[model samples]
Target chain A: MRTHSAIAEPGAIRWTLTAFAVAFLALFVALPVASVFLQAFEHGPGAYLAALTDPEALSAIRLTLVAAALSVPLNTVFGVTAAWLIAKYDFAGRGVLLTLIDLPFAVSPVIAGLIFVLLFGAHGLLGPLLSRHEVRVIFAVPGIVLATTFVTFPFVVREVLPILESQGSDQEEAAVTLGASGLTVFFRVTLPRIKWGLLYGVILCNARAMGEFGAVSVVSGHIRGETNTMPLHVEILYNEYNFVGAFAVASLLALLALATLLAKRLLGDGSHGGQGQPGASQEAR
Target chain B: MSVTVRNLTKRFTASAGSPRAPAVADASFEAPDGAITTLLGPSGSGKTTVLRAIAGLEQPDSGTILLDGVDCTAIPARRRGVGFVFQGYALFAHMSVRDNIAFGLQVRKMPRKEIAERVDELLSLVQLEGLGARYPKQLSGGQQQRVAFARALATRPRVLLLDEPFGALDAQVRVELRSWLQRLHAQTHVTTLLVTHDQEEALELSQHVVLMRAGRIEQVGTPHDLYDHPSTPFVASFIGGATVLRGRVEGTRAAIGPLSVAAPDGALEGAGLQAFVRPHDVRIARATDQSAVSLGKIEKLVRVGGFVKVELRLPSGEAMTVQMAKTELDALGVAEGDRVLVDLLAAKVFVEDYSI
Candidate 1:
């Protein structure tokens, strides 16, 4: 008697699924990205470079970098502390704390900006005190940074928490048993273990902070030279019907996204020079 | 340094508000200075919890731990001067073996040259001399365990705690590492508290064995004392291959299903007792032998290494096992289905109420 092999499906069925996936990715992702580069260079390289060097475009790039620089580090610190607290110990209302950390992911970015605006906007909560102190938050760089920080808050924590939890308390206890203090253990043992995941989170956070549009739009007031980030600048130029200028500046944001992807591929996958486990690469994702 | 734990107790509560039983309940034991003491028990026996409490890893609900006659229960694990080798080894995967061993000395802020020298010395001590540059994931399980041992010993801790140090290795590696651990213990002579469920490992490595059962210590004595004079049935059944036979006490003798055996001292009259007899102590002879107490049919014969194990069923339908040398079995010339007389030699009788 003959026995049937496992997974003895027809070859046509498998190829059909593979073809469908390829076609879907081409239509949704690759086409739009290719179109952006194609349109940006339509006016020739001279015109594209000229558009990018324009004063407003340069200021937008500078502002985007500044906002990302401020927000990513602040969020990174918060992320490590939050992940450490949530992962390392059992406490009351831990579920609620986790939900709060995840709040930004579930909330709409526009709504996130609105919440900050309601707290620090003119005629909003804390507005009277802020005005008395002569501090400007709404329609300023601070408001842009605030909105970007809120949206990117969960990335690092989300990446690092599961890694910490799975690694467990054994190594930390061993460190303590070896006469290491709490700070030394964190730096020498815990930090080195979770560094790859932490880097992966920070890269993604930096990318999102630079490209944030909806939340920054709600708060930036669109003051072109002062408050416009790269994503907001692309919108401003496009609204003025400067198509070449818009897509050119937009390509810079695309380049930032590509760089983020490249860095993630190098560091996040543990395929580069590192001793991190292959299992950790998936957690980095 | 000697270590003593007095009445350590710990309980884990379920999230649903039900209070579970204590993991360790009033468990107490002592590890003498310059000796190895093993906490021996099956899983859920709270042996590990006791070891952790002694290591300052777990906070006892109520107990005092004394290290070298100093009450150190409130001290944190870092300052307790105890080294623990976890069951999984818990080697830092990112660090090379040298850096892993150097971690404790580095944390103490030792001079750079001294730290390197100490790490080199430890690398040689655990016999992983040339492998210091390799990461933990590159080594075998036994090598990883040796690195963990080296790292724990780097601080020159007053006491060493090992939780099933060889639990993850194969049988041959386990035996090899057990002897390696014995030699290491002799050289260091740090008061060591080891927790293991393997009976043979505990009997072989420990100068004193503390037998635990269900969150309580059942007995604590030297290895020979616990093996030869087990105070309770759990100790007897747990330590060696002992077949239990229920019998009723008749004055100083216990009658077990058509066979009468001499009872242990202090067995009360007309009381139910359990006769714990090792397979080797159950002797077999021909039916014509006058000293035989009962006739049994040989049911099975299994040759195990240098000995033969004989399974027999008595006339009352109770089964018993007898182990003898292969030469003795050849002389007896008994085949399956043949009737033979059985004699009980050196059986210990315990009151059935004490049986767990």
Candidate 2:
């Protein structure tokens, strides 16, 4: 049988486009990251350790980690619940809910942060009430966490919704008929099926939460010891003319982004995994 | 457990651009304990709908389903103690064979040890003991079907329902599984209702066959009764491909196309009526020079199995078929273009007005 091999289209345009794309990516993406790392190592290993242990940089790293940890689980739970409702049920106002969930993604992060400020700032709506209640939202840890969460919320839902849709409702119904209670069926059958997708969603959410800057900057107030995250610290150091410290913080965030890329590769994008007993290979594809 | 469905009526409202077709209407039958009752019909014949209604997967407009004399109409599918093997086998793809079978037990909050023991028992019972670690996707089509059966039975339901269980399998697998299913049913003695459009399967496996058509039960009886003594013209034609011949009646004797048949019961609604004849019961005779035996000409002869299906055109230009055995065919030496005669022997006749 003569098969139409895709390899047969080894045209000049294909090779040219492939070369052009590789060259373009290397020049635009790979070079800048390599320069950052190369500069980070310009100082001796002792200077690198001293810069890493800087009190201001340490606080920023701790704040970013705390915010990401808080936001990732919250986003995960919200994403799974929303995805389940949208994918599994037919109800009124469903399209509106989906639009609202995706609205954060479409809207500018700066605008989103400004909206939170307008609602929680001193002269804004609910501002006086919050002050009287001593409930601080802007210029606080909650503000930074909330901003990051809003920007990162859609990652999990977007990744899991289509997976839930294609997995179908038959197996779950079969479990129900087998005398399994609702919770048991979810843990035993439904979770195993959706776990890989859920993990992918979580990884994306974590990456977004860790890297979020525009929204957090608008609300975080950038207090040195209290609220400044790594992105805000990087900007502060750059404005203060400490190029090495600024690049160092940026390098750490870049590393987190790199980790996310590696995670995605290992998991095979949730769809490419040899359909295993769902959660058995959660570490990788 | 025996299941009795009475006065079941379900009317499906017309969905855009199509006529309002009732999936099930006024259907009723009893599947006794330890017996396989098959609801046999064509694709749109409401057999599966009736089965699902009994399994509580479908909520009928009005009906009462009784399991062992207890009315279970209001009960949900989970509480009804009914196991359903879906057509597609709907196994949990994530779970291994052992885990799939143990799911119901684990949900019931059984002890961990008990769950494992019962899972093992089910695995061996389904003849999948060695493949306990395999996922549903890893198994062959037949093995997956057996796992599905085991998963359904692990709940220890009172009655088991299978909806076209072997429809997804190949012909050889289907036949092999049909015998295995029959043996499994015998060993477990669980009253089962299997819905199938395959008449051969229904005839071979079921103790009681319920033939349905157009949202109504055509006839319900033993397989022998349905095959041999069909009550309606539809049943006669649908069950075994019995051809109908229009005839004129005069008392007990009826004049068919170039032939005459005498009704044993001498029942008649009108002078003109229809006669039913099984192809196997009809005989073909070659023309003899001395005296031609019921003159006819063979229009087409199709060899099937050990018999040849002969479509003969009578002197009156009407066609009738006869299933002649290989030995009889060899002796008669009938060919497609040969001129012959057809003899109708002991064929049941019904009134033409009640044809459908």
Candidate 3:
């Protein structure tokens, strides 16, 4: 509420609060982001290019992209299936299923990494069986992917669940009565309704998959190129006092953050204008 | 399609383990081809459940759903070829009105050109000629409902099931759609099963009404049949404006205070009886009138549109609602607390005191 008295008016306080927020963001967020870019180009574009093109740096980038590539799609599929079942149906263990889906969010990323280690490490629960089959998981690229996937597993389901739960099953039932097959109903009606929230979840899941550190660090043996992802690669460069190389790779991650922000803006205004907002309450699909 | 259900019991799951859930018990009725049969009852009476069972959306625990004399209980909803308009319309929000109507046809892989012609025809038929490009949210509630109607009919299913389709609309809109639905039914002549708690909608829209109460099928008959000759007290009270009274009927001198009715046939002499009287059938007169049957005191007088509603408290302590013209009321010269006589012009009497 706006105060009537001039002595206690918001006119002065609004600007003061806005200035303080801007100053805080600039110092903590914008400054650090700018410094990373500035240091990446500290020795000019040639050095920045050299650092990025270094064989080990190139492999680290490849491994990070591959991990994200494998994990994001896998989680997106799992997330949609999970959200569909959890939101659309009622069963004895539905509450348990929802809580289990949120386990990734509740458990620390390091613990999530440890869970995979306990399952598939050399001395893990399945250690002997995995060795007998001549398969590797922990201390390998697969381990890094698994840890990344676990950390990012809940994003899509958490996002899509609320929208589906609110939208209700009326449309689906109507489609069924209209002679639409199960797959047809999902593709034509259900998917279009939930696509926006699903897309938002995918974006968040992909971002986390690309930038995960603690979980990937626990499982990744930091094999310089095979297992080390971008964050692990950055830590290695920093430990060796290779500031330029570290910041250069770190700038890539910062670039990803900027890209994600851009996507949010674009989707928020553009799709919400043309199509609609994600939520069922907004009547936007 | 002439849809029939035999020995039908409400069951949501096909798994044979638990005893039948007491939702709709032994609700067997036939919805004739080319006619609208309404399952009319209050909410929780399982009217919607019965309609869903017919649509194959719900599995009946111990019954056979016959569509055109073929057992369709095992068939899925899509294969059974039923069209359902949900209470909330359930139009695909993301799709344009055109796409919404075209969805059913497209699902069955109809030719593109034929689908276009069908959509155009439906748009015109539902009286929304140029609103096809608009999404469901952009359309008004009535328009969205019509779109759901047209979409349901687009495939020309064997039977159409409507579950309280006009429930979400305002009273005026519902009345408008009520007549509109009759016109559509007249034109299409589709076999339809409508589920609604609104007795007026059911009576006005359906040729047949299966009145249900507490998940039990009360009676099945035509609208006038159910209204004029309700088989049970529940039916009598549910079908129309009936004020039920408990009275005693003796040899020709019915002992219902404040009103007198000719002892209904077979009402046991000198025994308690349940009587249902319509509001318009009760006539109020001055206490000194010769034909006055019993004494009553006017408890309240309310001026409704085109009529004055008089609430009369009988000597039996039962209140009787009667509607009369203002002129008649003025002639009687009765107000609140005034003693008057009541003559029950018509009533349906039962031998058993069901009101008890």
Candidate 4:
């Protein structure tokens, strides 16, 4: 029904609160984002296009894409597996395991990078073993990918776990009793039910993987056009007082964030309906 | 195919840290080939768990499950040719009715052409022919349950396990599905095991009922047998409208507060014995019948569904209920607060002592 609450705020107070929120958004969000674009084109579109096409900028873009391509799919698998395990089955230490899945979220990203360094750096614990095995993880592309994955590890699990928990294993069990094998049941039943949430999680994880600077910087060894990811490259240009170049690259990252927000808003409708009453989507139609 | 469970015991490690209590303890039952047998019990009585154990959804700590005389306890659920209709229906939300029905067949690697044919057959079988392209969420609750039924039966599994099949439907829909299921059962005659807490459902739909109490099988017999002869106090109260009474057993006769009936077999002389009398069995006896009758004050009277119910209190304050036709109530001239001579036509007294 009639869903609005009986209680009502005074008109003056409601308008004041609405205006206050709009002002806050304008000050904190709209201003900086607009300024980034304005600054990027200060020397006109010609210089803006040149900065974007710079060899180093192009290399940074490729490196960011490569890292995301490597880390995102791997993290997706890990995320789905973790969420499925936590949601469907119970075992000893399950609470501990669930808490540990959010280890990335709770730990500082810098600390995440340092932990990898300690384990894989030249003078660290397993460094000698890795070097002897002809592995260069701490200051290489692999290291950069690992650190990015570490920072964004929890996004998919966080999104997918609640959906799995709410959806329950009923359909999966129904599939099993219908003589569908476990893997078949997962692909045919479980995956489709959580498809929207899984997509949302992947988008979030990819956005973070591309924009993460603290962790990737520690592991990238600051190699220009080599290991520098987009965020690291943006930092280098800003530090060198190349305002137009820095803002151009920063504008790209900002656009990516904006796209993520739009996609989230779109998928958010489906995700909420997925967890709603069964006839929700039909009623929406 | 026939289904048999032997000495099944499954203990859930309690979430509150107590891990030793078995949810289904030593439950054993047999569903004869091509018949509907129901496991009837209250919530937490473990009837559904026993059904799940049979479907290979839950592994019993100690049990042997036999399907058509073949031990299949060690088999996984996907390999066990038993289809289970979940309590929540669990229809695939993403797939259309056709694809949902075709899922099992496709998973079994049936040819594409045969799957389409089978899907069409099942859609019509469930009377959902034209709705093949509709998603589960697009269907009504009854239609969704029917789709679930069709999906489960698509592969023609040897045994079918239905966990509270109508538990999710509202009153009118439940009544309709009950008969629909009966007709389906008659047509297919697949060996079925239904688990439900509703006594009327179990009594009406199943040929045999296994009554459970506190994770133990209390009695197993035909519905008529459970109603006519209950072996325990739990069965007497659980099966139908049997009002249990506190009484004492002397020789072969049990004496309730204001009435007496023949004690159930082996009910030796004892106090605190319970006598079970159905509402219809206790009626207004003739005034001059010379029966040892005690007067009871009608405490409450209400008309319910083709019959009049009179809840009475004896001199000793023991309460009893008797239901009779409205004509009978009128002919006897009994109303609320009227004192009348009550007689027990049928009473079951268990020999094994149990608190009322």
Who wins the lDDT comparison?
A: 1
Structural similarity to truth (TM-score) of each candidate: 0.94, 0.86, 0.94, 0.94
Off by over 4 Å in 3: A1-9, A275-285, B11-21, B289-293, B353-356
Index of the highest-DockQ prediction: 1
Q: Chain B TM-score of all predictions, in order? A: 0.96, 0.93, 0.93, 0.95
Candidate 3 lDDT tens digits, B1-356? 79998888875543334655578888788889899999999899988888888888888878889999999899999888888999999888877899989999998899999999999999999999999888787888999999999999999988989999999999999999999999999999999999999999988998898999988889999999998999988888877788889878877756566456788666667788778999998876788764455788888999987799889888788888988898888888878998887788888887775444
Clashing pairs in 2: none
Candidate 4 chain B weakest ten by summed lDDT: B284-293
Candidate number that wins on DockQ, 1 or 2 = 1
Pull out the clashing pairs in model 3: none
Q: lDDT by residue for model 1 over A1-285, one digit each (tens)?
A: 556479765678889998999999999999999889988999899999999999999999999999999999999999999999999767788889899999999999999999989999988999999999999998998999999999999999998998999878898899989988989988988887788889989998999999898899999999978888989999989999998999999888999999999988877546344544532333444
Residue B110: error of model 3 in Å?
A: 1.3
Tens digits of per-residue lDDT for model 4, B1-356:
99998999999886667896799999888889999999999999999889999988899999899999999999999899888898999888878788889989988899999999999999999999899988787799999999989999999989989999999889999999999999999999999999999999999998899999889999999999999988788898888878888788877788887678988666667756778889889867434443446877788888887788889787778788888898888788756766778888989876555656
Better of 2 and 3 by lDDT: 3
| Cα lDDT, all candidates | 0.89, 0.84, 0.87, 0.87
Estimate, for each residue in A1-285, the C-alpha lDDT of model 3 and write its tens digit.
Answer: 644875564668879988999999999999999999999999998999999999999999999899999999999899999999988777778888888888989999999999999999999999899999999999998899899999999999988888889879999999999888889989988887787788889889989999999999999988987888999999999999999999999999889878987886666565664544222335333
For residues A1-285, could you state the per-residue lDDT of candidate 2 as single tens digits? 656577665568789999999999999999999987776666756666667789989999999999999999999999989998999876678888999999999999999999899989888898999999999999999888888989999988987888778767778778878877777777877777777778888988998898888999999998997899998998998899877787877888899999998987776754454555443443233
> DockQ-based ranking, best first?
1, 4, 3, 2
